[model samples]
Target: MKRRIAILGATGSVGRSTLDLVERSPARFEVVALTARGNVEGLADAAMRTGAKLAVIADEARYDELRDRLEGSGCRAAAGAEGLVEAASGDADWVMAAIVGCAGLVPTMAAIEAGKTVALANKEALVTAGALMMDAAARSGATLLPVDSEHNAIFQCLAGSRREDVSRLVLTASGGPFLGSSLEQMSEATPDQAVAHPRWSMGAKISVDSATLMNKGLELIEAHHLFALPSERIDVVVHPQSVVHSLVEFVDGSMLAQLGSADMRIPIAYTLAWPERMATPSQRLSLTEIGRLDFEAPDLERFPALRLAREALERGEGAAIVLNGANEIAVQAFLEGRIGFCDISRTVERALGEIDASRPRSVEEVVALDGETRDRTSALIAESRP
Candidate 1:
């Protein structure tokens, strides 16, 4: 039977890549639904191509346009966050939780609650509510699959292995465009420079996160929850090659690594066909042609986001939520030329320091803390400006 898939954030980079795979072999999969925040044109186009049964626009203002576009196409159109959530969990065997940032959490939770296999591309869900999500998965019998390249790689390497035999999980980083730049060099960097990631193509926020090493930091926290590993057992290595997605060190003095060309489709396909493997339109790695790979320790003095992330993961008192919210705001400000690139980490640090450091008893508490931190971080940015 063909798998019925609902792709959230169908207009974004990861979403588009997934669509490419589905379109390549329509006989193997069916797109039950497609959703976008406000890009009705892209959403409608995707729905039409995939012959999706439903199209959703998270922005209510675009509902009419989306509806009109899909009117005679036999696809239904809906709007708002509730619509997005409904489309995510309605009539689908698998849900690609690709909606970027924290906005994706609720519907992603809904998908799990509805017992759909979730292909999680949104890192914030795990970073902010990994424990809750894991618990929900266990209770609801939902299969939570990793779609992020690093986490997916780690998952592949650790497949069929006993959890107790694992020693540590090492996530690889391309180190972004400012890999070897000094603190002075990064302090005056522009958003354009920061978003020019060295290896992978990603969105502005994630690209900026990569430059500050905060993406890796956030992934570290996500890894802690996803792999059930502690902060002490997880490590980040700056691998300029990015070919080695992630590694798992076994207690038996052996390290297992997953390597491939730097492409999101590979991991995306892996999740789409979990417990099985499928071919993707990704380039195969030519080890002889590449010739070499280099690894180095991240610099704490230059990229304090990594350290702050470690502290947040270790503390686990809504600290990760604060760090993520502050970083998102600061990155948006930096991208708009409102702040220097270096200020991103500084803003996150300040926001983390200002938060009450209270342990969240629920996901609602996490959102409350996230909102408070974002408000304060936005105010700080405004106050700092001339």
Candidate 2:
């Protein structure tokens, strides 16, 4: 039988990659539902192309537009948070949680609560509410497959290995666009320059996160939750090549790494065909042609976001939520030219300093803390303006 699928954030980069794979292997999967934040055109188009049974728009105001767009496509339309949750919890054997930032938390939780095999592309879902979500997944028996290339690499490397024998997980980073730039250059960097990731094709916000190295930090938090490893055991390294996605070091001194060309489809395909492998059109790695792979320690002096993320992970879940929330606000400000590129980490640092680091015991508390952090961070940004 074909795997029934629901893709949240179906218009985004990772979601599009998934759609590409599913579209290519029509007999292997059935698109049950498709959702997007506000891209009704993209959502409707994907739904129609896949013959998805349902399409959802997260913006309630766009319901009419979405519904009208899907009128004759044999796909029903819904809107707002309820619509998103409905799409997630509907009859889908697998769900791709690709909605970006904190916005993904609810729908992602819905999928987990429904006990679907979830391909997690949104790091913020875990970064902001790791413990709670993990607990929910455990209670619901939901299988979470990491979709971030680094986390997926670690996941693949750890397969069939005894967890107790694992020494550490090393997550690779592309070091982003500012890897070689001086502090002064970063301070004056433009949004266009910041989002110009050399290796990956991604959405704007994630591209900015990569540029700031906050993406890796957030991944560190995610790895902690996904792998059940402590902050100290997980390390980040700047790998400009982006060939070796990540590595897992065993206690006996052996290291296993998952290498692939810089393609999101490779990992997405892995999750889609879990317990069984599937072929993808991703470019195969040619080690001879790409002769060298260089690795360096991340420069905390230049990218303090990584440090802030690790500190937040050590503090507890509440702090992690705050760190992610604050960084999201700050990244948007930087993208909008309201703040200097360097101010992104500074804003996160300020918020972390002022916010209470108490652990959130429930999803409600996590959402509340995230909201409070975003509000406080925004006000702090305003205070520092001019």
Candidate 3:
């Protein structure tokens, strides 16, 4: 019997990489469902190729197009947020919670509630709704596997170890494209320059996050949840090589690190075959060819987002939700040229300061808080507009 799978963001980079692996070892896995936000063509093509039982588009307006494209494929087609939730909650043993932002929070929670193992790639889901979702997973017995390379590295390093014996987790960063650039240089940086990441190929928003080192900060909050560690226990280092994905230091004066090629597929494959390794076509790591690896402390002055993230995590009172929501708006604004690139962190900081982050007891409240923060951040952007 093959392992049944439903990839929520099946048209994304991670989704495509996962599909690549599944396609090669077709007999090991069964594609149960595939979903995309608005890429009807990509979703339809994937469904047709995989022979999935269902395909969903989160954008309701694109439903007819998706349906038409998937017409003769015999796979069921649906649209809207409800459609996404249905696909996530549908019959499948594993669901890839890779949908972009807080939009993924609900469906991810649905999968967790249904007790389906979830391969989580959306850091915002945990950033915005950590407590609520983690609690839900505990109640439902859902296994939330980490797919982010950094978190996945820590996960692999700590395997079979006593959590109580683990001292701290060290998450490595590539320092993005602006590793040595000054704050002045960064302020004048263009979106194209910002998104030109040195190591990983990613979507625009994440690429910007990486450029600002905000990506590593968000990962810190996520590690707090995933590893049950506090902000003080999680650390970050600027590793330009991206070879050392992450490191874990034990209480017994020892450390373990997971190094691999700077490929998203490595971690995706890790989560796919979790607790058991699987063969992947990902490029193997060659320490000899790579030669030396460099590491340094993140420059908080150049990238204040990382500092802001730590402060938010330390507060632990729904600040992560506000940070994520504000960052999303600011990053998009930056990408659109509505705000200067450096203003992204400034906007998030202002929003965090102005917004009252009360602890959310439920997912509904978390979503509501996220919306409120986005609105406030938008207002700030408008006020800053010339």
Global lDDT of each model?
0.91, 0.94, 0.91
Off by over 4 Å in 3: none
Assess candidate 3 and give its lDDT.
Answer: 0.91
Please identify model 1 stretches exceeding 4 Å from their true place. none
Q: What is the C-alpha RMSD of each candidate to the true structure, in Å?
A: 0.9, 0.7, 0.8
lDDT of 1: 0.91
> What lDDT score is found at residue 352 in candidate 2?
93
* Candidate 1 lDDT, 18-120, residue by residue in tens: 9999888788899999999989899999999889999999999989999999989999999998998898789999999998888898889999989999999
The clash count for each model shown is 0, 0, 0
Residue by residue across 127-181, what tens digits does model 3's lDDT show?
A: 9888878888899999999999999999999889999999989999999999989
The digit string of per-residue lDDT tens for model 2 on 330-360 reads 9999988999999999999999999986888
Model 2 misplaced regions, further than 4 Å: none
Report residue 191 deviation for candidate 1 (angstroms).
Answer: 1.5
Which whole-number lDDT from 0 to 100 does residue 184 have in model 3?
A: 86
> Model 1 compared with the native: what TM-score?
0.98
TM-score of each: 0.98, 0.99, 0.99
What is the Cα-based TM-score of model 3? 0.99
